[model samples]
Target: MTTGGIARQVVLRAAATAAGPALLLRRWTTADADALVEAYRDPVLRAWTRLGVPDAGAAVRWVEAQRTGWEGGGRLSFAVVEEEPGGGRVAGNVVLKRPEPAGPAGEVGYWTAAHARGRGVAPRALQVLTDWVFETFAGQGLEYLELMHQVDNTASCRVAEKAGYGFERVLPAVPPFPRDGHLHLRWATGGPVPG
Candidate 1:
């Protein structure tokens, strides 16, 4: 299928405004179940996401949970589709999760589909999402965007670099992984100017 066809099937129209040429950043939808299954079932995706292999039922539940997060507020998950000649296929996913009580800092996370790897999709999606966060929620104190990648995931680090986020530092005690854990990298954007 063409990328446009995949986009029409995978991308939510409401979130289309947040899209760019190389990628589409859209809100999660219940209807995304099928595409979610197709994308998430890839072994590479499972590795990067750390979400484990999902059955069809599990995939449905996962997409539903993402939608729930939107309704609940303070979290925004976007489906990233690569724009090909005839539109684009669902390349992967990205997220801008607002931190509680931290004020204006958003944590960013992303994963690219196996087929779309090495094609510059993730960084492009990140740039669009970052721009959208600044424009849509800057008034609400959106200041910095932070990302953490498994040090072993060199490709992800490259994407962060391409998107203009500097290497911050490696921190220990990171949760969901290990105490002696993943390296943390942070980038500040759209925050109040210092005195």
Candidate 2:
């Protein structure tokens, strides 16, 4: 799909690591707004992200925000889709945010659709995004990526670990995040996954 404001669509693919199917990661198009709005309908997703995407309009705005981030040269996001003979479908979303144009650190976040859960979509999509950020932003300056999720979000904990993000610390509840969070880190090198 064509990405708004994105000069070149960066598609990241990872082959089936096991029984899970191969997956494709690409920019979220306006067409995916409906899927995103539907995804936010899931209570599980809403509670975690604390997002108020109650309709298509909000989803469109959200998609536009991602595009703005892309055009600004930071905060990359993707619509994780599973490739199939029939075609690819939105499996989830993965974002690598806060990589300042001249900074050394960034953050990673992702969520799997209700239908795509338990198939290793979160971690796989995360791995693909992680790899692309560190490589594609070569001169922009990147040394590490952090992932923070509520301590009770065991699924995210698993995704982080599976994606090779080492448990860094426990973060106190702050504003939007009501519960303590687990901060996971994956360094550019000399850490888990080794750059």
Candidate 3:
């Protein structure tokens, strides 16, 4: 399979969490299907997310497929959960998926729930995910990391900037939208890679 195609197969297992401000990144499980459905079903989430699944049942099946990919060695998909302020369930979720090839680098895609907006969740989760990706996959010839957000997603742009991703370019009329015109902001981290 192609690198990107292979990446789609890999499922990222959960990472350990320690005390003092932690961002728990883990692989999706059957247990999380409900949470995934609930989060993705939100209208705001539906707007920005690129998920292809049509319903909750499909979401569950998708997670299962990702698990199979995890067992293989293709892609990494993670769920971001933060500890509550006082003590309870995690606030919500932030997700990062590793794209294949990424042309000498890795591409990251992320999203945060409506309830978790403006809480710094995306930035924190992004930092952890990016650091881990670079460290663990350095041997894979990765030189940079890339992220993209719709022109209208100011909040996402802020997170990318805060996380140290520099603006690289803008693609006009890509990923066309029905109403708003197409415009995408591309951001990069680390540095340029040799061809």
Using lDDT as the measure, the top candidate is 2
Candidates sorted by TM-score, best first: 2, 1, 3
TM-score of each: 0.77, 0.90, 0.72
Global Cα RMSD, each model: 7.1, 3.3, 5.6
44: Cα error in model 2, Å? 0.9
Pairs that clash in candidate 1:
3-88
Cα error, candidate 1, residue 171 (Å): 1.5
Off by over 4 Å in 3: 1-21, 52-55, 84-103, 175-189, 193-195
Cα lDDT tens digits, model 3, 57-98, are 887897877676555445566766664567323334434344
Model 1 lDDT, full chain set: 0.66
User: Which ranges in model 2 have alpha carbons more than 4 Å from their true place?
Assistant: 1-7, 192-195
Model 2, 1-195: lDDT tens digits are: 333323567889988767578999988889998889888888888878867678999989999988887777567889998898898788899997774556888998999888889999998889888888778666666778889999999999999999999999999999977899999999887465533
Scored by TM-score, the top model is: 2
Local distance difference test, each candidate = 0.66, 0.85, 0.60
Clash-forming residue pairs, model 3: 6-74, 7-74, 7-75, 9-69, 10-69, 10-75, 11-69, 11-70
Per-residue C-alpha lDDT of model 1 across residues 76-148, encoded as one tens digit per residue:
6788765558766777788877646248577888888777777677877887776666666656665677888
Better by lDDT, candidate 3 or 1: 1
